[model samples]
Target: MELSPSAHVDTFCRDRLPPFDLWPQLHFDLPELRYPERLNCAAALLDDAVARWGADRPCLLTPTDSWTYGDLLRRANQVARVLTEDFAVRPGNRVLLRGPNNPWLVAAWFGVMKAGCVAVTTMPLLRAVELAQLCEISLPAVAVCDHRYLEELQVADAPDMRIVAYGGGAPDDLAARCAAKEATFQNVDTAADDVALIGFTSGTTGRPKATLHFHRDVLANADTFSRHVLKPRPDDVFTGTPPLAFTFGLGGLVVFPLHAGAASLLLEQATPDQLADHVADHGVTVLFTAPTAYRAIMAAGKADRLAKLRRCASAGEALPAQVWEDFRTATGLRIIDGIGATEMLHVFISAADDDIRPGSTGRPVPGYRARVVDEAGEPVPDGEPGLLAVTGPTGCRYLDDPRQETYVKEGWNITGDTYVRDADGYFWYVARSDDMIVSSGYNIAGPEVEKALVVHPHVEDCAVVGVPDERRGMIVKAYVVLKPGLTGGVTTVKELQDHVKRTIAPYKYPRAIEFVADLPRTSNGKLQRAELRSRAVGAAG
Candidate 1:
């Protein structure tokens, strides 16, 4: 399909998408999955809300202000006008959006889509060198940034890129320029399969991988997971900690709530205590955050404040059984744990309420299919650990990268996760396939050891990785963050070792344990095992 109509523009993302055959099998059998051939997701998500629901409906809320659907729609329209008329952005142009999770960021996201420009949203915490790597990959023509972040983007060394900053009162700022624009705009008519966003995965080594998603891919996620699994209502208030740059946040905090005609609170910073306080004060019904955040809320003694929440979604990392049980014991709400990847737009495997199995990542969402497979891409029998493979409407489409072959093989997206499916079809997460540690002829999932250790009273957070050992080839090493006022001495180390031995197989216990104030994590809150491995190597050397 011809997605872009403008003649004078760059088609970088579209040109770089992996061949069709390399894409995982896409299914859209559900009635709600039907989408028009030509679509602008922004119009469907924003403009349609004003038409279907009333303009007076609450859409976005911040600590200081709340915006109705009409307000967001008009602002997004003004942004589109500013981009096309003032910045010379045309259809098929690439625009980079930089900011934390806030109303302006959401407006800029819709503005890019309305103008038919592919949006590239980056984490606010990324340094210049990392930003330089992204610029080298997507080559965005224009960047809409929060004014405070302009210096870093400038230092990224993209000579040709034009930047427009907002969040400051400068006359040249995007908000200032947008003030003069009309509150109405004719959105570009983009095809369903048009590249809408390039989500960059925060990999530990080498350049980050840019995952391409079509305009349809965006709606598909909301329609599938949000519609079926979350089942959000119009009165539901959504909030989360994941940055919009992460597809997890995009789907959970933005797309899902909007699709349901619900209100969302955008926090520039949502620490665990703050998140819990917001839930109580705002009457938030649903929350989307990481497992760590959930654990923190319980640890900070703010779990009771979250009594107002009915549904709590966890992702970005595995939800340990201990954490899940502790949360349920405190809040009486079973946290919905799902496994999603940047390649697949959002959560495909998830279960809510009574369907939730504490430790297992639930069955696939209605529109998707999943399986555990061997190295040869063949199915592994139930109860056997294998690669997690999924096929659905949304799949991996790497931008100009040959790793496409490694991610999507024979119509299944290899998620790089080791999983074991029980007789009942619940998928139990083992670890990142690469994270499985082989020590002394024994296979141990690092996360399993971490899970056992995290249940200890003194442990706040921890990571387990295999370190090279002359006698055993490799030995399990754990880096732990202890609770406040708890010291990690020799006595504590032996106590944790004994605890792990008692919890699971004795051989799987950590042979070495180090104490740290915090564990390294990606901006999206996933543990950076690769960095932990490097730290272990450094300590051993």
Candidate 2:
């Protein structure tokens, strides 16, 4: 597989891509997936949309501010100028973006793309140590952070990474620098296959891996899922709870909306109550969030505020069948449940409207194909559970990691989950085939949590597992063996929880902790996680 002539001046990312033979098969069967060899996605999504649609149309809508398509271009252009002039960033240089979801964060992303630099978006909830690990992997040359959350990033060890703060009145802030730059500039001519962004995802080992996505891959998702399934209208207003750092939110709030010339409302933080109010006040038609939030919104008795919503999407965790039936009964809207991975980018398997099955994650999107295969990759009989493998316009491509071989087997991306494909082609939910804990729409690794817990001085050993929760689909539970004569009680639990939170992202901290004499281990000295999961399930019940 010979490569195309790249537009990136710095070839670090292209040099690190897994050898051509190790790459997953990418099929561009859909007409929309066809793209020009020389293309920049930022220019395609933003510049082209403004030209096709009127410049005066609202593009990004906040609660108090509305940025027209033309306005967003000017801001994004300024940001691009600042990157090249102030920070000395070159094309293909990794620029780490840290911030909550907002108009500025969106602008920074576009600006990075326009300048031909790869954007590395990290979740705002990540603590200092987690951020440091990502920075070490990507080696970002510059970091753009929100002023409110600058402390943790400042403490993180980012090699040769200069920090620039946004959303501040300080004279040296990113906004202040942008004001001094020109309002217009020529965008970079990056190739369609050039790496545009790197999203970090958790592996079972607890260490994060950088997932590389090309400029065309960004639009491929919108073309396949958003075009065929979501079917967005130009007048639609989209809002969601997932942070922009996550690919789900990026597709829903930014890529999908911009691709369709629709308006998006960027909320930095919103509870179920506040989200309901925003929907009613702003006439939000397209909504995206997890099933837990949908349940919470109804429990808060804010169902009336969701009267304006027409389409809703649920992902991150599986949408329970009962919750789906209950929400549909109340709102007269059937939520679209999809299964997507960081590797695949966005919802490759989903159902919308009349095609949706309550208990099944619907058929593959128009462009993609899915299969349930045995250990040897042979197709399993219909209704029998096996590995869920997917391949289409987009698939996983890890940057310079040996795990690439594990993720991409043969020609398909083998998502580490077991599922059953019915005779009708509807894929039903079963269970995760790996040790990942999907709690509150976040994928947490048990090994990662165990590493954080075992570092505490009072802890002798620890095991983390996902336990069923009525509220959240699953909650991270930890069993710990204390050192010496400490009879662990509430005080011990609180101390250990705080320690784990400080060591890793707060969301990965074990919500439920129990004292144990020892963890179960097999004769080979490997931890028996299956036995513990059973014990945790019993204790949870």
lDDT of 1 by residue, 1-541 (tens): 2344432256777778787777778889889888988888999998998999999999999888999999999889999999999989988888999998889999999999999999999998888888888888888889999988888898997888899999989998878888999999998888888899999986647778999999999999999999988899999999988999999989888899999999999888878999899989998999999999999999899999998888899998899988899899999999999999999989989999888998999999989999999999999999999999999888999998889999999999999999999999999999999899999999999999999999898999999999999999899999999999999899999999999999999999999999999988876678999998988899889
Off by over 4 Å in 1: 1-9
For candidate 2, the 10 contiguous residues with the lowest summed lDDT are: 521-530
lDDT of 2 by residue, 297-322 (tens): 87678988999998999887567676
The true-versus-predicted C-alpha distance at residue 199 of model 1, in Å, is: 0.3
TM-scores of all predicted structures:
0.98, 0.83
